[model samples]
Target chain A: MKQSHMAFMESGNFLYTLDRFKEVPVLYKGENIKEALQEKIVSTDSSLSIFPYGPSSGGMVESVYFDILTQGERIQKVSFDAGFKNRSIKLSGLSMGDALLRIERMNGVHSAAYSSMFCHIWEKGIAMDIPDQIKYLRVAMMEAERISSHLFVASRLTGGASQNIAHMNILLLREELLRAIASAFGHRYFFGVNRLGGISRPVNINGFQKKIRQISDEYREIFHTLMDSRVFIDRLDRSAIIKGENSSGPAMRASGIKKDGRNLHRYYEGLEFKTITSDGGDALARFMVRSGEIHESASIIEQALLHSGDLKPDPEVNEGSDSFMAGGFMETPSGDASMIIKVRDGKLESTGFMSPSILNMEAFAGSVSGNTFADFLFGYESLGIWVCEMGDFQ
Target chain B: MKAWILRSFRKGIITSKFPGGRNENASPWSTPPVYRKGDQDPYCPVGAISQGKADANRCISCGLCYPNYEPSMDIHGSVSSVSVPALKKSIRIYQIDVGSCGACNLEIGALANPQYDMARLGISFTNTPRHADALLVSGVLTDNMREPLMRAYEAMAEPRVVFAVGACAISGSLLGKAVSDTLRIDVTVPGCPPDPFTIMDAVQKARGVK
Candidate 1:
């Protein structure tokens, strides 16, 4: 009979492991590694073994048993079983309202990604027909969210400089943007209005378009004011330096990669907008790029609203099929987020999410090496980690 | 430096003049809800507002009653004369808690800010029952809070004003039907958390200060 092992990782930074084995296997060259001494020096056909483990930082050690069919301990067939912490979201037997409420309780970016992931998996994959208009609208909305998040991060970074005026100004602007978002969609941070097949509520074209224009003008004036502040610029410059070659996504593009999802032509084909770039792959460059992207997003929204003429609503799905796998990639405020889904029997089989922060945490660890500890916070803030800090329940 | 200083100065005095002259630039949602006579009242989801009984202590600030109720209610609508059980020259106010989310607390705390300045109007938030004139509480009546809430009300000096800030406090909107507790609140201001101005107006009405 085969045995299993389980490890529990606690939230407050502790790891506990319980391992059980039914058979005591003969080992070669194990005298150096085995710490516990065996009693009676007897070879038994079967024995039970239990081992406890702790965090080693050298990756978890998980192993399983296999019956050896060959000589010299070389097995013909081997089965490996390993288990770690399970932290995936479960969305089952929930109404749309309840589902959205649950998502809102999640981290804000994760909530956005979850919605986008669902749309990507079910709508785009099964329907096989997503209107260019809806795609463009989504891109525009995503860019808006990105700009808002970046501005908030930049504001916090500037707060360390005692530039409370800029900080307050940015917060006010963020609040206004949130109001606009709430007006457009029902909820501010969590747009519970997005549904499968199509939008639950049609965009108030006139009001939303006008608000976008106003926000654009306001952003231009505010960005100019922020740029004028030498203190702000000084603090932002050469901070959180990431080598252009190593960085990817918006961070890289802002650091002069010139690669943009908006330019992918699936949504933004022939869309007239400026692609802003900076040679300096530093905190200020990231800030400037995000600020510039706001104007670009405003332009996209204007175009989308203008082109959205007499559009027909898409058909709704009463039920969905199974055994389908779909993945989606969206450029959020911090960086790119990808969601992979596997659906079976009209329910999600397994879902995986890769957030920019998870990847950027490594980048942050790399960048902060040999730098002063004070720079760590500024560097992290520049990456837009702080925007969702208050929103993190888990 | 000079330009920056000038810019800061030019932004200029955006402070409010409250508790003195008429409040100019009052927040659009500042006015509190008022019960009126000869009008068919809408049933408050939380039962914070009804025909004759307006319990300020039960208000949850959910903003469902003022515009939603019949008789075209405003936040600053006149308090009905017939509804009062007691007649006193000076009205006393108190805030108590049954069960509330933290939004009302923050909004009430906002009174301490430079904009509202409730202290100038002789209104202050007091933690203890002895110092409190009115118990300004927000939330639905939960089982655990019933005894404590009643005790607080009993402890009040007398002629107390209990102002409920949201629909939750008034009739227990979402929490009303399911709540097993027999506790009740008074004078509900409806809104998810009634706007700060609505709270101020409610406070004024409770004290006959307006």
Candidate 2:
């Protein structure tokens, strides 16, 4: 055999080779790529643009740069630039409460998760526990946010498949959730709800409970229609495969990672909750994971709502403290989101946020590579990559 | 096929009745603020208040002012008298995110929801800037986004209108720096992120459509 040299790079568990020919059998770190590969190789090239808009990146944010290489119609390589960086410079030097407000806007889609995680971590660092009722309320709101976030992804997926009806239906369900959130939380996007110690305003427990039950039932019906549609499933299935171990959140769960933050969180430990996973790591798998999680989220909300009576209004627990430092972590709709806070003399000295979007960005190119150009949206939406969240992480 | 049609029928018509008059069912985030004699700046999270009155352009509608001051429905710059005759009737908008939190984008998306189907009113979102008669921009213009935004604006034909969609776009809020200095903002839809109904009202007023 004429020895041909090739190199391989790694993303999660998958080793990707840039070589066009398999006969070469790429090498990695002075070892044969084939010998070390636990999973199959993903070959990619980033040359021609597939989308009419070039890269076709729009979901969760306005723009994300995807450089696609195509041989005729089939995609050879897909690489992405994570767009312009939007640092959280405005957040620095603000009071703890003000910083929290800015953090919610860090990524609008992940606002609730960010605020919840910040409050959780801040309290932990400060050595204070939120009331059980407040914990339940926070869980309910986070779940609601998750439902909406997943629905947004599903809507984009269906819309990309040209299934307008399914797309419209999913969007409607999301809108219903938004309406409920606004009615209960006082803001459609759930901003300013989470504060340093606890929630700013009281939640309408009965109203939220009633709204969720109705919406969840409606969502289940709409989701069934989507799943039953052959076109919808066909568009998503096997198109964008993120290996089992390489991803997180719905993407990870879809690939059989039973890693759910709710499972480990103290608040959700007592709640009747189970992580949903799928063996397939494709777009359909991710879609399925999201759908399954929505049902789980609703169930968790109902369970939490049952104990809504235990909730107390925001207490002045250790408020106006001169010096304190804390960190909190929570699972958002996308994946693990966390925050760190340093307060000096009642003013926020500095704070940091790490959203799931940051980790998921690593897999964006790999997920879309080796797939057809038309299926690009399905892959991108399936991953649920929020650009601003990723950009704000540094 | 029958199942599909039946399911569609069950959903019924859910579009909002805007461009006619105010949507009677539309809920203001808070009742219009009744500016009392007391100082109210400390209560607001976004610093939307100046002197005594609430600046609707900067308000996020968190309702923090309600307990202390009576709410007002008066939205500043809600009325746009500058009628772009070229964009009358059917107008296509291209959305560009300079750097938004995602709320403004969703609010713009809400316009297409069943409650506010902006398409039915002859206003639609276009993927390409070339086809757009107006640019619906959200976000605080970041350094990287400014050039892309300007390029998008230039791609549009003559008589283009720029509709700044939120507090970030209008007044640069907390996240945005000053954006109006670079581009001519024809209309500013204020709110932390304006609701879909308010957005439509501003669009209708700008187009001067019947």
Write candidate 1's Cα lDDT for A31-108 as tens digits. Answer: 311322253212332232322221110111101121212212211111111111111235554333334333432334
Q: Given the true complex, what DockQ would model 1 score? A: 0.03
- Give all candidate RMSDs, comma-separated: 16.0, 9.3
Which ranges of candidate 1 are over 4 A from the true structure?
Answer: A1-88, A92-105, A109-114, A244-249, A309-316, A386-394, B1-210
Candidate 1, residue A164: Cα displacement in angstroms equals: 2.1
In the range A234-329, model 2's lDDT, one tens digit per residue, is 999897788856666888888887898788888786899778999888889988889888888889889987876534347434456667777767
Model 1: lDDT of residue A191: 37
* Best model per DockQ: 2
List where candidate 2 sits over 4 angstroms from the true fold: A1-61, A85-87, A309-318, B24-41, B70-81
Please provide, for model 2 over B118-156, each residue's C-alpha lDDT reduced to its tens digit, 9 standing for 90 to 100: 888888988878888888888887655555566677788
